[model samples]
Target: MASKERKTPLIRVKNLYKVFGPNAGKVLQQVKEGKSKDDILAETGHTVGLSDINMDIYPGEIFVVMGLSGSGKSTLIRHFNRLIDPTAGVIEVEGSDVMSFDDKALQQFRRHKMSMVFQRFGLMPHRSVLDNIGYGLQIQGVAKQEREKLARYWLETVGLDGYDKHFPANLSGGQQQRVGLARALCTDADILLMDEAFSALDPLIRSEMQDQLIELQEKLHKTIVFITHDLDEALRLGDRIAILRDGVLVQQGEPVDILLHPADDYVEAFVKDVNRARALTVETVMKPQVCRISAETIGEALAEMRKSKDDYGYYINEDGYQGVITQETLEGVEQSEYDKAIDPSLLDSVPAVHTDALLEAVIPETLDSEHPLPVINADGDVEGRLSRSTLAEVLSDQAGSEEDDEKVKKLKTSKSLAA
Candidate 1:
């Protein structure tokens, strides 16, 4: 994804630090003075849950906070809605300080502005799927008829229309999570906070739920704060990912950025086992080597290819890439009339892939053909070329070099220094 139009953050967490023990707030000074989570714990018996955590969650984006067990991923998410109060920090939603809200204001905020989906599905076993989905609306004191109608609409939205009367116990894990998701949506809140929402499902069911959230995001554009430990899940769902270790933010960035340029050894280790084939796209390794030949004749096309030092070139009109003219095609038309229009029949078939296509998908095409696969964008325009060599390099475990790591470290250092 190229740079999009900048939008102000819908939620901001500033200097957020959470300490979980009796004397939690008392350790603020030690925690802020560059003390490690373990050090703070050993000295004060207060476990550092989050340390100097800051984030600007933009609207209509899935911002993922992920870490291993006890990394405070869940702890950090809870502070967003004041489910757990920070030891010392600020949480703001739409310019309103979360900590400043009174009991009534907080209740109203939770009901109207945000909804949560939990790891356990958090459904009432006694209630029907329809009742479970509408539970948030029921809490809001909405009329029974209207809440049921809204719940039914979301029931169908999450692909569980006929099973409305069924209880949570009757459904599979995937279906139950869909009910949780539909429950969150029924509130019509601007923000959705999902804390390990799909972590309980089987591999296939997990993947299915991930796909569902992505599809729903495309249409609804809710400001989502998703928590997950699975790298694949985070990469697939998060617009941006923040990696945590022992409650400290190790790195935060786009999936490609994190994969190609990890911030630290901790982050590096976490991502080393990630499946790059599925994570990387053709655009990442593609070169801008499309030799455009606007020629009237085969001679002109041959001249263009010679000048570019390429064995083949594509005939491009305003419409887009037409066809390939290889050296073989040129030799066959060497004696043709120099001024005659190039015969389309003589052109060689060129393999092509979309820019967003994964490297794994394009690797087969590269293996099958000798020519570079033209990378086409959404507008049917040739953006670049994906060669076999480039694909090989990307697939290699050492896809990034030591020099690349250095550059990334310097970049992160500079950012930290500036901050």
Candidate 2:
């Protein structure tokens, strides 16, 4: 993670507001007074496109803006490129105010500083694959040979090799979108603005495109502002997500944080259907475990267990977590053998889960094992232990919270009726 103080933000939007229709500025007072979107529209004949939206986008992060239709997700991304003017507030890119830019400066910014990939795969039907990919560079006045060279490289990078001579009309929807991605990438801009880039594709193809984008991001690390209406897509791709509702900023945070702690009922409703078992990692539910050494005798291991008050403990070595040791093994050993190293054959063969492993994967391993599941880091060192009880407890807490929220709502309604 980049230090906030040391690293400057790539993009910053503050108290941004956009309203459509004439005299849109006149509706600001109504918005400040907490009037609803529908009320403002009925009285003022203006539609609120965005409301007091503020967020900082860090470099090399995929920042996702998502909402249902008319939620202003598409409207919000347009502010980044100054494609749509905000009725109020600040939009700064790299410390410069984008709203203050002259036409010439704005043109330069769009041409060189950033690129957009539209949902429609905005490729000219008359242009060949190579021509479409090289279009951006050509517009920048690069020589024909040089532009084609860069275009061909990105074409192969996007897995569209040997299709350079083909036209957009000849390609499938997925392939056409790849051309659009290649074109934007060909510009080599520091920032990318993707507006529902994969929403038009079929389910399987959309998933494949998402994987491709993730793979490309690992290598390129460009700062991206992706717009989407799909919750699954946002969770899969967003480094940080900002959800909008009726032009208002609802919540914004890492996917895991948003999943674990929704800010309000609206945000909770959005995440309620998510597969928590598959979404949460082992680290979320793991507990600290008492560790024992492989060379230790049964008596020594038993002593450690008694001290920790744990029924069993894990045997660890320099290489990594070995297996589980039980109280029975410690007690069954002969008096003479009690001081010897615990037998490896008698080890419980506990299954280990990586820190990044989802709880869904941990379920089967823990169901049959008597000992707590060992959670290991990438390097195979045991970090903590997870048990079925702990898993159930975390899940129950989530369900209980929802139930509690319903109770609160009912109480509020009852009080209102009494009053």
Per-model TM-score versus the true fold? 0.88, 0.87
Tens digits of per-residue lDDT for model 2 on 307-408? 666667788866677788877777777777767776678688988989878776666666556667888887888888886566554544333442344433
Give me the runs in candidate 1 sitting further than 4 Å from their true place.
1-5, 295-311, 326-336, 400-419
The alpha-carbon deviation from the true structure for residue 103 of candidate 2, after best TM-score superposition, in angstroms, is: 2.4
In model 2, the runs with Cα more than 4 Å from the true position are: 1-8, 284-303, 331-339, 394-419
CA lDDT, every prediction?
0.84, 0.84
Colliding residue pairs in candidate 1: none
Which residue pairs show collisions in model 2?
none
Residues 266-352, candidate 1: write the lDDT tens digits.
Answer: 888888887676887777778886678878776787778778867787677666787777876776664646667777786767777
Give me candidate 2's TM-score against the actual structure.
Answer: 0.87
